[model samples]
Target: MTSVQTEVVEDPKGLLNEDDHMRDMERLRMEIVAIRQPFDSVMRVTGRIEPVDPVTWTLPNVAVRIEVESPAGQRPVSRVYTIRRYDSALGEVEIDFVLHDDDSPAMRWLHAVQPGDDVWMTGPRPHFVPDHASGKQAAIFADETAIPAVFAILEAWPADATGTVWIEAGSLAAVDELPEVEGVEVHILQRAKDEAAGTTGRLFAAARSAVADVSGWTVWAAGERQEMRDLRNHFRAAGMARDDLKVLGYWKKGTSSSELDRMRLAEYARMRESGLSMDDMRDADIAV
Candidate 1:
């Protein structure tokens, strides 16, 4: 309900202007070039953004926030998605939407979108990539939502580095789409058709079983909030350093993304009032 409220929160103190805000927050108009269903559980969209800077747009694990309609159809809401692939030469980027039963903002946008449709978005914000350079074995745990990021990350994976990827998905076809890297072994944890996405604790279970010692590994994981939070805490308790573990909660089990955004903005405002910067606010620290 709060998500549909039309209220503007202005930054009178200009805190957003600091750091790389201007460069990273530039809005871009993307024209949908094509849309297809590569797998039963995913909708793949390819769009083109004009005047693309190869240097900035061509990065692994980059994400964009696309504006969509709120549930009540009263206000515009935005959803963050990963760039599955980026072709700077063609000025094209592909994003994969993991289909769900919920009638959320992103699902509405996906159903209504067409080839000629234009959408406004801000970002190509780079996210974490595995620390292959650390000379430690990388352990990655992802669900269907994070498969796109894993796709891009593996495309640019270093040949000399060794890692293992565990993906939990309801569709095997989705997992089959990932690239075959020489040093990386990908294991699929198949979910039952009737089982809900976030309810299954398979990813966490597999992670705990496979990774006995954290000393030789650097962990990168993303999925449902509670699972990722548990994974992060488990690894930390196993003696893994903070820098060595990169875990993110892409979504929560029973919460809407709009609600999550509303809470984030409220926390951000509180942080600003307390003379803190964006660097002090961590998504993992946010209470759902």
Candidate 2:
């Protein structure tokens, strides 16, 4: 059995003794402590289908809401995900998973999930909602693994909200697998699709074009830590403010998680000590 926090109510104890009063006070204190504890939850979702599109999946919010169960009575360690699709009729929602080359907990979970078997998830807590009225557009970029996040962003965007998306894939075959978006001008840059399709070069060129016209643009790029940093520099040179761009090194090439974390920490320390700007990192060869 699990202990969950609940609201405390003060009830009059009819016992006419001070000892009884003390017991009641102690009980009240215990209840208060329990109430202060965070709610930890997880959900066991069954019968989820593997993504046929490779870029997105469909899982319903109903299952997601109920499948949340607490594993350790601690607040659920939920992650922010881009919802690829939410099917009301079929009662399903789709989430994109970033599958790295090596195994990690999240990747392992994705790999191990069977069609009939259930997967544990915690929260779909909403975070940022874009401003559609401001005439400002959302700019998104993602590599193969982070495509789910990109899809989630595109899926939730308002019907009239127009934007641009840049995706990097291994080959033309991978690019052909991309989903269609009505308002989004989706561009697939093949990174190593033979020697001809240079994805990074294509992305850099596309971004340069976007940065040239800053009318309605908020840029975001993820994947290939080094590439993200270089892209950031490219935008900065083109006159985009750091605030307008959201760049992240979702993962680095040939880096262990520990190494990546340490490298980031070291970068942070350097920035703090020297007050270096994004441009500084680019010149110093500090890849994202």
Tell me the tens digit of each residue's lDDT in model 2 across 1-288: 112221111122322123421221111000000011011111112233333332223322111211122235443222223444555445455554443345443434444444444544423323233345656786776676456556556555678887788777664443344556677787776665243222345565667776577556878676666677778788778677666777766556754434453454466456645855433443224543
Per-residue lDDT of 49-93 in model 1, one digit per residue for the tens?
873455666779988888765335333468889988888778899
Query: Which pairs of residues clash in candidate 1, taking residues 3 or more apart in a chain or in different chains?
Result: none
Off by over 4 Å in 1: 1-23, 70-75
RMSD (Cα, Å) of model 1: 2.8
Tell me the number of clashing residue pairs for each predicted model: 0, 16
Which runs of model 2 end up more than 4 angstroms from their true locations?
1-82, 86-93, 98-100, 103-111, 115-122, 125-133, 171-182, 193-201, 258-288
Looking at candidate 1, the ten consecutive residues that score lowest on lDDT are 1-10
Per-residue lDDT, model 2, residue 105, is 35
Q: Which one wins on lDDT?
A: 1
- Residue 254 in candidate 1 has what lDDT? 77
Alpha-carbon deviation at 241 in model 1, angstroms: 0.5
| Backbone clashes counted, model 1 | 0
